[model samples]
Target: MSNLTDMEIFARVVSAGSMSAAGREMNLSPAVISKRIRRLEDKLGTRLLQRTTRQIAMTESGLGFYERVVAILASVEEAEAFVSRGSAQARGTLKVAAPTSFGRLHIAPHLGDFLSQNPDLSVSLDLDDGFVDIVGEGYDLAIRIAELSDSSLVARKLAPVHRILVASPAYIAKFGVPASIEDMAENHVCLAAANQDPWRLMGPEGVVTVRTGAPVKTNSSEVVRECLLAGVGIALRSTWDIGPELRDGRLRLILPQYRASKDVGLHAVYPSRRFLPAKVRVFIDYFAGLYGASPYWDTGLETWLGPVEEARAS
Candidate 1:
């Protein structure tokens, strides 16, 4: 228990960036904070920090140890929260990872309501274009928009995703709509980013792979969207992404007969199903309710997108 207390104090000192600040936060005097630091250093038999009048600097060993210590402290907090508060009560920082565009567009907008409901919980939402190491990175959950599943993490479906070909009305007016898939492939310009090549679209005649001759290719999905809206070319996009545009007539669904494979959907993934933290549970449930079988994005798209098939995470 003393060791754990020392570790917590050490972490607090590092975070607060000064012994005086840490002492203030922990309600301990600077003398006590300094003594605890010395005790920790003596037990480890190494200098974790370089002490000086101006500012403290972490040694090379201290930098690595600090990283591990923060993760350990987070784990300790989670365990205590679970044991003391029970699974029904959420009172810890909920670290979450999500895709960049989707998180900003969808999840971020609704965080106010989620946080208001679970006032005891705080959230750390990290958005990136790539998948994260959920368990290894100490994330409480992740939001995925993909066709595949990770064997290690448990996932729940939030909404069905429909990736369909779309183009600005002006572009279709100028180039004329493709009569068939082959016509589109031969004639129209397709827009895609890195790792989004060789379109794997599911059509009435099973799956068809179309190689893209993209005029405007970039690494950002937002760039793809901008180009699509500017009438640059036809690109495949999820309804959640361009739903408003489709509804407002800024974009029109081309190749409406073919769409993304049924495997693609919006999912909330976490490390395990057993003993799901209440913070994680409420966030997932809130999103599931926000975008159930009929998501807000697909509400007024009956004429454009037609009927959507029910998708669930297994």
Candidate 2:
């Protein structure tokens, strides 16, 4: 009677290639299957099949409806499996890939707890700054922290990526706080990662671009953070990477009038949205719980300097 039941029966019939075959698969009489199909056609106000003495064939509308019904049935089954297994039942080897610096600083450190919670699960983490073929390499998950490119892979945002310019207290004392982007370029040494992407910031008026060279540049974000900590120069760093430092007064956030474009986000990328494995689902859930709306790393720092928008307004 329900459309969902009608859809499932119709899909079974198409997949089995005959009403009799569908009845056998579902343990129903052929008459019952025929009656259900007839009811479905009547509801839709269109003929769905052409029956002959030898066999039956789908009409044009039936073919289209069958395709969608098949997809719906698959989704329903996957949803059932997901809830049945849940997180506690998760078990498997989950191979993951992540950026070298972020993996080490954030992910690698927290993996012990994750593994402890899911005792049956195992993980193989690939930490590299180079591009990794997630599906080609057979990875179960990937942690990406950049502007995501359009792709077939499904992505879930785990946290927001907010980058701000920062300098060590010692560096600020030595060089004086840069009042503006233009002043920063002229008076301060600009620390940079090995990548040559220009710093793009958004202010009340519009976007501002800052380009400058450092005496030292490395491909590693950790190295960039180290250089900034050693009073090398100012560098734009993410909150996840530098939040502890900022909270502890080891690093001073500068140029409060401007905010990085916030174009990037921390994401959990996987091959498909449908039929998500319990292992991958649980791992993503762990991150969502850990980060939530306000991450642990961001604690105390907000009170110290106030939010960026408020600072800009004042």
Candidate 3:
């Protein structure tokens, strides 16, 4: 029997659940359907299905093989479409949601180049701090900076973000630098938006929760940085967001000994679909190429500012 005919028969049998049902769908006799399945099983040297009078079920290996067949069929269809279309020029609106700070600082700055590259592609960026439903809210993609939870959504790691505790030199001068996590409670004032808690620092010794009287609170990191520059209070924030400020001496590291949670990761999350759109894939690939290896966030402020400070001192 031809491979194509065998595959069609196998697929029909799997979908229809019984040889008789598959025969009815294909307008063939039940005996013919059973014979085709037997030939396929002989070629593969595997028992593809467990047949009973009541119902038909695939064996464990049979299910795995079926999954591969589905993927192969999909790829074949995609290849045909690509060949027919000549080029995969994605022409559609790409809606994206991202955190305000990351969107403004990272994505917004680079989006112009992407738009220029794909002239037909129109992008709408919704910048918000809160989580937005990519499927329900109708966003094609969302850039998130957090620990990912187990979900059906496809999350691709674009970059790594390091959260650092920082304060203004003036604030540190007024209330000495914290030597340990414990010192933060007495010496530092926490600056975070409503509903967000101050970061807890953990080291080899133990864990320490830094509590503070609310000195300044803002939803935007840009606002937080503004307040920090104005000598409001110390804040634990992503290093990528504040590298320039720290390099310029607008902000100083608070507790060098204790480190905040190092688990902050940058993800490009999108709703899972049978076929991912080319535009979404292109953007994700571009983002990964740009930021995957060494994200600006992973570059600590100390690395960028240490030389500048040395030069100033010299």
Candidate 4:
């Protein structure tokens, strides 16, 4: 029992990044935290951590031990949770990384409801466009929108990301709606990020790629959205991004029969599937239920574009 307590302390120190932070979290003095770590090292007959004035780093052995200890802790927690069932309440700081626009539009809005439910837990959200190193940077989860090719990480599909061809009313009024894919080739223009062209779609015929004439090409997604809204040209966009515009009639669907593949989705990615923390589990479950089958954003959209396929998230 004493050894298990020491192991928990050691794990907390590693996760908190410092003995002082661990001490604060556990409501213990720094001296006591340091003494316990020393006692642990003495019992194991191995140096677990290398301490400097500025920071603390784990020894190679410590890293290996930490991985095992984390799994053990998760198992213990899971067992206890199974017994306690409905009474179990998640309590931890859930550090998450997410895309800038999606975080602002989707996650940030719903956080209040999550926090209200889990009073003991806290959240640390970091929004960026670049792919952040989840384990290296110590993030609990990363929300990504992609057709995941990397098998290294475990992902839970939260919602489907359906990219549909759309144009603002003004653009359609001026240039006219594209009658067919060939008509798109000859007559219409596209406003999309330069790198994403040519557009790939699953049409009535089959999988096809259309490289439309893009007079305005930019790297920024925001620029593409703004130009589309300003009646520039037709653009293929995700429903989650343009739901409000589609709902309010600011933007209308152009090619209802064509869309991107069904594999692409919004996923909650984590380092390991086996050793998931309660905080991370609850967060993922909440969003999974929130966006299940028919997401709030995609509501009333079927009337415009018809019934499109959705992700089969279990």
Best by lDDT: 4
Write candidate 1's Cα lDDT for 63-165 as tens digits. Answer: 6676566656666666787687675677778898998999999989988989898999899999998869775466878999887644756889999887889
Candidate 1 colliding pairs: none
Give the RMSD in angstroms, all C-alphas superposed, for model 1: 6.1
Estimated TM-score for each candidate: 0.73, 0.69, 0.68, 0.74
Q: Rate the local accuracy (lDDT) of all candidates.
A: 0.82, 0.79, 0.74, 0.82
Score candidate 4 by TM-score against the native.
Answer: 0.74
**Would you give me the overall lDDT of model 1?**
0.82
RMSD of each: 6.1, 10.5, 10.0, 5.2
Q: Which stretches of candidate 2 lie over 4 Å from their true place?
A: 1-88, 303-314
Sort by lDDT, best first: what order? 4, 1, 2, 3
By the TM-score metric, which is better: model 1 or model 2? Answer: 1
Q: Which pairs clash (backbone N, Cα, C closer than 3 Å) in model 2?
A: none
User: Candidate order by TM-score, highest to lowest?
Assistant: 4, 1, 2, 3
Model 3 lDDT tens row, 74-192: 44555565677786655468889998888888898898888888787888899999979775455778999888999868899987666667898888778777776666777567777
Runs in model 1 deviating more than 4 A are 1-87, 307-314
Lowest summed-lDDT stretch of 10 residues in model 2?
A: 305-314
Q: Residue 25 of candidate 4: its Cα lDDT?
A: 98
